[model samples]
Every structure is written in C-alpha cells, then in structure tokens.
Target: MTQSGEVTTLKGESTDQIFNLKREASIYYSDSLSTFNDIKSAFIKSAGNSSLQMVFLLKGKLNGYLTGSKKACLTFAEQQHNILLINEKLQLQIKTETHEAIFIRIDPAFLSMYIPADHLGYLNLKDGMQKNEPALFSGCNLHMTSEIAAILNALRTSEHTGFCGKLFLESKILELLVLQLSQFELRKDDPAVRQLKEEELDKMHEVKEFLMNNMNQQFSLRSLAHMVGTNEFNLKRDFKLAFGTTVFGYLTDYKMTLAKRMLIEKDVTIAEVSEKTGYKYATHFSSAFKKYFGYLPNKIKSGKLSLLILIEDFSVVFENFVTMIP
Candidate 1:
C-alpha cells in the first residue's frame, strides 16, 4: 500500500488496484478499488466544494460512521450503491473482509451542465451537513441493480491502463451520472409529499419500524395503523408522503431486498426463501420477485442473472445514450 496526504493507496492483483485521484475541469475522483485485505479505519475530510459522489460496492463490507454519531451512517454490503454529497469529514471503519468499491466525485457545476438550466433551479444539489438539513440528492446505501454491477465490473477489471483506461473509465462515469439524472427526472414531484408534522412523522416512522421488524408477517392498513396509534387513512397518506411510496410498496421492496441478500449470501432453498419473506406460496413469491426485479429468483439463484442486469437492461431504454456509444 502507498500513502500520500489524505490518500492511502493499496495494491492488489491485476483486478485489485487503486487508481490515483483524477481531476479535470469539473470532476475529481480516485480510481476504482478492489482490496484484498482489511486495514485500520481512517478519516477523510471533505474538499469543502460541493461534490456529489457515486459509490459502488462491488464486494465485501464497508462501514462508515460520522464524526460524532453513535453508529455508522453508511454501511455498504456487497453489491450495494450509494450517492453521497459530502460537506464534512468522515470516519471509515473497514470490516475484516476483502472489499471492492469505486467512488466518482462530480462538481455541482459539472452536473448542472447536463441538467436543464430551468429545472436545475428547482433541484436540491447542495451539501446540507452544515445547516442540519437533509442534503439535496443524497441517497446512501442504495440497492445495486444487476446492470450497474456489470458496468462497475467492466470498469474494475478492464485491462486498459494509463491514458486509454482513464479515458474509458471517465466515459463510463459519465454514463452512470446520466443514468442517475434520468432517474431523478422520471420521479414524479410529490407536491403532496411534503414533510408531515413531527408527531405524525414520528408515528409513521414507528409504523415503518414495526413493519420492518415483522416483515415475515402480514397486516392490513387498518391493523398497521392501529398498531402505530394512527388511523388507516392518515397512515396510508402520511406514510407515502414521508417515505415516497405506499406502505405495502415499501414492505415488498424491503422483503425482496432481504430475499436477494439471503439468496446470494447464503445457501437457502427457494421454498425457504418464500417462507422467510412471508409468502405462504412459493409461486406468489416468485411472481412478485420477477415483477419487482424483472428477473426470476431461480435465475439469481442459478447465477444466470445478477443485480447488475437491471442497470444493463435499463440503459438500453435510453436511445440517445445508446446511440452515443459505439
């Protein structure tokens, strides 16, 4: 491993390496990472500039805690992704396993260039760490679709090195940023999705915690609302307003997330997965899984399809981007 200033470099095999930080007119980033050993935790002070970061966790586990937080604010298990807007220093605690991850940092101005100027005014792309407000466009520990994972793998394992490799990697990074921006553009503005009153939000959160804890069980809206000391109408509306989706939508997504993790990380059977995810019928589970991920659970279990396929497949939907590529 090598170290200089705030950067601590580690060496691995051909597939396991770290590229030095690259900078241009509007972007700055360290090369991709695939580490084979665990190292001590360290601190990374932000550059003060408002830079949005897209982080891909290809393999292993990474735990990141804020300076004064009691617990980790960011945890990247294998095959997860995160988009971070950094405005303060951070402490990283590496787990005792090999880790593979990549980070791409974008200057806000650079990002603005791609976004329509009028739409850009309404976008929340600022660092909210100092003001104690939520950072605009901040999404931490997000799920990694199969397609994105493939792109990350291509970037990580590509034989291209030096200038050509750098150029290729930069192009891939731009592609990813475009994908993310397109996603944001498609999101319906929740004019009605404003923040709920503190008490209502707290109650809604309680309902969410209860649902997560009892994921293997089923409940109606009325029952869930009663459990959390709210009515069904308010529960349904406020939960969606606070969490950006319906109650069951979030639950199903959460269940499938766990199902994917269990299927990949363990040797559990399909029926076992169905039972664990609260489906009495394995067929029901399979159908829901296919609907949510656009692939079968059997494919995921058989190693025929992976989470990366989602990004790969979705990118083809953008005809302009597809035409731009050779």
Candidate 2:
C-alpha cells in the first residue's frame, strides 16, 4: 500500500492518513481531536470524478453538507455507514471533535472490473455507479453489521507491509463492498419494498434516535408511528424496509443489548438493570435475558462468562433472534 504521512490542521490536532491501495482505489483514515470547546468546521475536497465513496464513522459525531447544498446537511453517528456517488467536485464541512472514521473511494471503472456484466442486475449499486447516477443510499444510514465491523477492524489494524499489505487491503475492500451491496440485493426482488423518500428516511432515523434515547420508556407501534408523524401501516412497512426490522423488534434487540452491556460493565444489580432497560419485573428481565443470551444476567456479573464468549454466544443467539423475528 502506498501510504502518506499524517498531516495536522489548524482547527485542532487532527491526523489524516491516506492509503492508496491501487491507482483506482484509496482509503482515507482520519482522527480528529479538537482542543477548543466551540464547534469547528472544515472543507474537504474529493480527488476523483464519478467515484463511489463510502464513509464509515466508528466513533463520535460528524456533520457535513455538500459544497453547494448547505440546506441538506448530514449527520453521521458512530457505527453508521453513508455511501454517496461523487460526480463532481465534492466538499464536506466537518465538525471538529474527537472522532475516528474511515473513508473509502473507488473509481467506477475499477469497481466494474470485478463485477461481471451478467451479474450486474443483482447489484443495483454497481449499475447506478456505472451510470453516474445518485447513490441508492445517498442520505440513508445503514447499520454496520458484525461481519463488516470485523473486516474494518482488520483493515485498520493489519500489520503486513509492502505488497502483501496492498493485496490484503484491496481484498478486504472488495469484501466490504460485496457485503454492503448484498444488503441492497436482499430487497431487490421483494415487491413490498419501495424507495423511501428523503423525508420518510429521516423520519425513520428520528424514530430510531427516539428509541435509543428513551430506552426505559415503553412505546407501542401506534405511539411510535404517531410520534414520527406517520401512521402505523406506513411506519411498519417503511421502517422494515429502511432498517430491516419491525419497530418493536428493534426496540427489544436494543434493550437486550443495552441490558447485556450494563450487566457486563456496570456494577449494578439485575433489578436495577431491568428497571433501567424498561423491564417491569426483574424476573421477566432475567427470563428475556436468558432467552436472548442463553444465560441469565447474573452469569455476566458473576464472571462465569468472558467477554469473548459473550460475543460469540451473542452472534449465534442474534442469528436465531433475527430469524425468529418474522
């Protein structure tokens, strides 16, 4: 990999490292640690035309807008992926804070080399990029999966150098692209799925934020739909299309995940964790936890299960959880 040394900026002590995997593909890893209390912004320039850019925010919050379109500012949070098609010169206004992110840029022609024309129909993103069309997920925030997260961590922490490193990075990038594109493929043949408008997508995200912030509060489908200015039917349909989960399903997963984290990290009792996670009764919470993780919450607190074992168990249990959802 062709690597560049880190460069510091004036707004704060930030380091940006660029890795040119090949002539047509590159990766930009950025770490920004702002010193001032006030929010700062910066303009970023894109190098290639008609390139597909994927932004993965691993930590902190980032807000930006295209150079000419200040009205449509975008906010990206941790573990969110935003894919965009850059047909012209693109500039980003970044907020200065303690943040870490990875930006991958791929030339359409280079990406097309790997995807056979006959199979292109299955990959909507490839076809769109080839035509210089707007990205299908331009304003949407796709949740990062565990598999994608593992690849990203490898890409960031790989120790191989020289040609071996270049090969490793390129292969990982293609693997990442395949995983991301496969998500879109899942809905390609589903007639129930429809393209969500920007407003509707924003509403879906708003509902997600509301759930994450108010985890202790119980919400019905009707209440959440009304809270986001949509009806239950559309909310149920569009939310599933947008986030790949039913409304309450996402809530249950979120609560269970939070409960697990609390059990492992916080020195709190099962009852406290249960109350904090919106459970009416500790017994009910323990039952749900056991069902979700294949073990009771006390096991986590008692040090019977290690973190690695918990992660592996959660993966298996989550697969069962998702499959049992519908």
Candidate 3:
C-alpha cells in the first residue's frame, strides 16, 4: 500500500499496498488514508485523529494487554477494537502471520458530528488512556455478526471489471458503513446513534476501491479497521448507506456475474473457472454456481441458450440441475 501518512515496516512476512477506490463525489470528503500496512503487527502507534477502525484476521493472531495483564488473543475470523483518548499514551500489541485486513480513515470532525459538545461527559469517554489496570471494556476484540462476516467474504471477491466496477464497489462500501453505523448504540449506549450524513455516504467509493483491488487476499474487517482508522461497525453501516446493499450481497453478485461471463464467453473447464474465481473445491463451486445462475456450469458452456431464456426456462430445468451438482 502507498503511504499517505507515516509508515513503519516490521521484518516479518509483509504485504502492504494502497488501493485507490473510485467514486463520484460532491461534498464533505476528508483526506485520503495517510497510513496503512499488514504483517505480524504489534504495538500500534497513536493516530492523530480521534480514530474509528475495522480489524479482522484471516489467519494468525493478536494479543492485547495493559501494563502487566495477560494477553487477550485474536485469532482466525475474529475481530478486535481499540479506542484511544487524546494526549494519553496507551500500549497495544498486535501479532500476526500471513494475516490481513481492510481499513478506512475518519476525521475527528466527522466523529464529533455524532457526539455533541455537551454529552461528551455522559459519554464517559477517555481522551488519554483508561486508568484501571483491569478494564471494563476488556472485550477489546469485537464479534462480527454473520451478516458482517458475509460482507467481509464479499469484500474478498469484489472486482473492478466494467464502467460500473467502481459503482458496484462504491455501493458495497456504503452498505458496509450503514451496517456498522446502525450499531452505534453498542458503543455510545445512547440508543440514539443518529443516521449518518449523506455527504459521508460519498466515502463509500473509497471502500470499494480498497476491496476491489484487494479481492484476492483474505481480508478481515478488524484488520482493515486498524489500518484505515475506522471500525467494523462504522464500515458496515456506512457501506450499507452508500451502496444501498450489504457488502456481501454485492460481492456475491460480483462473483456470480463473473461466473456467468466465464460460462458464456470462454470454454474454460468448470473446475478451472471455479478456482480462478477463488473457489477452492470444484464440487462446491458447481453447487454455488448453479444456485446463482440456474444452470450447470457445463450446460452454460454449450452456448445453447441465452441467459434471459435460461431464466425463462429455469422453472423447468432448475430443480433437476440443483439436485445434480453435488
């Protein structure tokens, strides 16, 4: 990833690059990501802004401890959260191997919109660091909902293939944001985390850029949240709003769309096509493939029917093929 901010490198296995997501914008955009990385990471430094982040681990681990506490572990498919107050030093250690994440950055001004000037007290927020050695918000790692997991899976398969490639990604990003923002009550506990600004919706394009470019790598939401300075909740919520669909929904369709294209435009073997599209097993790929396209991958290769006609004829043959894929 290209560094827009200060960046440091650790000597372990490293995969770092920047993705420039595309979207049409009118107003209320913030600065692009200044920093990002993915590796066996530990001890993240403080960001300048009051940060929001999303972190997910596809593999390897994370350990969080304060002062002299035993480590809180993050593992495969798990997510974690951390919020730091202003001017206070906090120690956080992250460790990983062949792990990855996707992230978005939000300015403090953007966050201030959610928290009013007066309620900052009842918010009981910290600026520096938590004083207690044993913490109450000890569950620093988050639990991603199934829906959130689906979206992350989708993010892993997004593609920038057409004029609307960016458009597809833009919408997915927004959907992710909306999904996350809907849960503000979890953090604020105010029961009134209001709707996000429409202008904020414009940032969905940035998210799309990240996912479409990084589709091949296994990406977890929490890992990304840390890199970009936003959290899983915010990404999901804003993504929903910006895209008008959940992240996974868009990704599912994108992958299936490519499958359909491969079925029609080329003579690649069903197994080859499946693996190329990132499916590991041909049998499972065939099942998922037919479920999406209403025909066997082999049948589609024959060029015997138009896609529209296949849908029309689906009522008759779909039931038969669905049973045969396995």
Candidate 4:
C-alpha cells in the first residue's frame, strides 16, 4: 500500500483501488469502462466479520444475486446508495457494465463506540445484526445528495499522505456513515411511517410524483391528501415517514435541484428559472437558492466557484438551512 493507504491494481480494462483505514474500516473503489462485448461478472464472498457495508454506485449498473437465492438480491444503478449489515457468510454474483462504485466495510463495534446504545439507529442495527441475516439499513435505495457526492469526491481524490491521510480518510468515512444513520433514524422513529400499509405507501409515492411533476404549482396539505385519496393528517404524517421530509420540504428541494440545472444553461435567466420553479419573484428564488446551496445562482453561471469550495460551503451550512425551510 502507498503512504496514502491506497493499493491499486489494474486488470484488463478495469482498475480497483483499496484503502485500509485504521484497521476497522476499508474502502474499495472500482472503475470498469468496457463495452457490452467486454462485460464481466464478479463473485464476492463476504468475510462474515459482522461489518456494516455501504455501497455507492456512481455510474452505470450492477445486478447481483445471493448464492442460495434464485432471484437477484442486489440491483444498483448510477447515483444510488445502499447500506447492509453482513454478519454471516454469504456469496454474491455481480454482473457489471461500464460503472464506477465505492464500497465501504466498517466494523459495527467501531461504530458502537461512537453511537450510544440508547440511540434508535444503533438499537435497530443491533437487533438486525443479532438475527444473523443480511440486514438492510435503508427501506429503499437512497438517491445521492450533493453532500454525499462531495464527500465521495473527496475520498476519491484525497492528496494527504501518511498518518494525516489516514486520519482524513477515517473522518470522511465516519461522516458519511453518520449521514446514512441519521436518515435511517429519522424514518425508524416515525411510527406513522412504520404503520403505513402498502397502499398508503403507494399514495405517498404518488404524492411525491405529483409534486415533482408540478413544480410550477403549489399544493396545500389538504389538497395533496385529497388528490391522493387520503386525509390530510395521514398524508402529512406518512409523507414524512415515506420520504423523510414534509410535502413542501420535498417540493422546495426539487425546485432547488431543478433551478440549479436550469441556471447552468447560459441562456436561462434567473427570472425565467424562478418562474419555472413556482417562485413568483426572482429575488425570492435567489434567496431560497442561496439558502439551499450556500451560493447565489450567479456563481454557477459565472463559473467562479470551484466544486470543492461550493461543497465546503454547502456542508458547513446545509444542516442549518434545512431546518430553516418549511
């Protein structure tokens, strides 16, 4: 391994890099850029060390099945993340196309040291680990957030060396894990979400789709609930459980994401983008954009801020900003 704790190997058209961090955590990154004719299958057998495994697929697709299961147990695509607790020996067959992914294996005991036993996330994880079955931390595949993307980018391009490098890498890994756990905790603590029937969950998804498709419009809790054939209270409660955010909260994030993409096009003005995202005034849209992204839309248009700087600013302010939003 290099002083940066990375060991790299190249086989055929693929490159794999492994970083061992503090003996309790390790990171595996793979990039495969091959045509359909050169596709490959990889078989992975778990070490059965009771570690928590987090996987992030940045590009392309991966499909896999367990050793005993006839059906595919794993399917990952670009911009998706999943967390699993591996406590027993298991084998997986994975087929990959042109893709880049990062896998992190962290000892649960190491996490326990940082997370209190009374914590809902730790308790849920502990219960799952004791069952001796592969446990999923997320109910559904999580879409990668800008914050997560930033941290992953840092991990991929780290420049620090030796002990300092190890420390930096460890800290980043822990930060990423904490973010995942917090999301799980939020959903787990929501009893309304836990009690949701399949039909109710479907309604929540429908609500989300409607909000996303109608960004140029606004809906109150009662109107959305009515449209989904549910009551306002159930809609408000279950929506948070299903998506980890309020109806309006989700809409605000969607609008901000769409606005950012629109701002990147040179011909799109702030006023036009604001209108597209349901903001009556450009100033209101700019204020919300700055709050969500920690920078004005003009910074993106001007190309003045580097991605690293934007990430740093966003990370510092995102938590506080989210709470300020409705």
> On residues 119-159, what C-alpha lDDT tens digit does candidate 2 reach at each position?
53325566555665544343346655545656665565455
> Highest lDDT: which candidate?
4
Q: Top TM-score: which candidate number?
A: 4
Give Cα distance to truth, residue 31, candidate 1, Å: 25
Encode model 1's per-residue lDDT on 1-326: one tens digit a residue.
Answer: 22211233212221211244334212221222322121111112333433456666555666766768869776665545556654444445555534555665554555554555445322544425335332435342334443354455455444554555555555566666655554444343424434356588678768877887887776899998888888999998887655556888877767887787677657888899999888999999999998987778888778754435434444544554554343
Please give the distance, in angstroms, between residue 251's alpha carbon in candidate 1 and its true position after superposition. Answer: 1.2
Task: Assess every candidate by TM-score.
Answer: 0.53, 0.53, 0.35, 0.58
Show where candidate 3 strays beyond 4 Å.
1-199, 307-326
Q: Write the per-residue lDDT of candidate 3 for residues 1-326, one digit (tens) a residue.
A: 22222222111112112134222211111112222122112112233323333344332344434444465432223232222232212333334334334443323343343334444321334332234222211122333343454455444444333444334333444444444443432445635334345344335455555665554567676765555567788878766644445666656666666676666666788888787767788898889878976767877776675534334433433343343233
Please give the lDDT score at residue 65 for candidate 4. Answer: 52
**True-vs-predicted CA distance for residue 163, candidate 3, Å:** 27
Question: Given candidate 4, what's the lDDT at residue 91?
Answer: 41
lDDT of 4 by residue, 1-326 (tens): 12222323111112222244334555666654432112222212324445576778776665555556777665664556777665434443335534667667666766666666776556666777787655666655565554576677666655555555555656676667666766665556656445456688679878877987787776688998999898999998887765566788777777876776566534688899989888899999999999997778887778654454435544644554355233
1 or 3: which has the higher lDDT? 1
Q: Local error of candidate 4 at 32, Å?
A: 16
Clashing pairs in 2: none
Error of 3 at 30 (Å): 28
Instruction: Return whichever of 3 and 4 wins on TM-score.
Output: 4
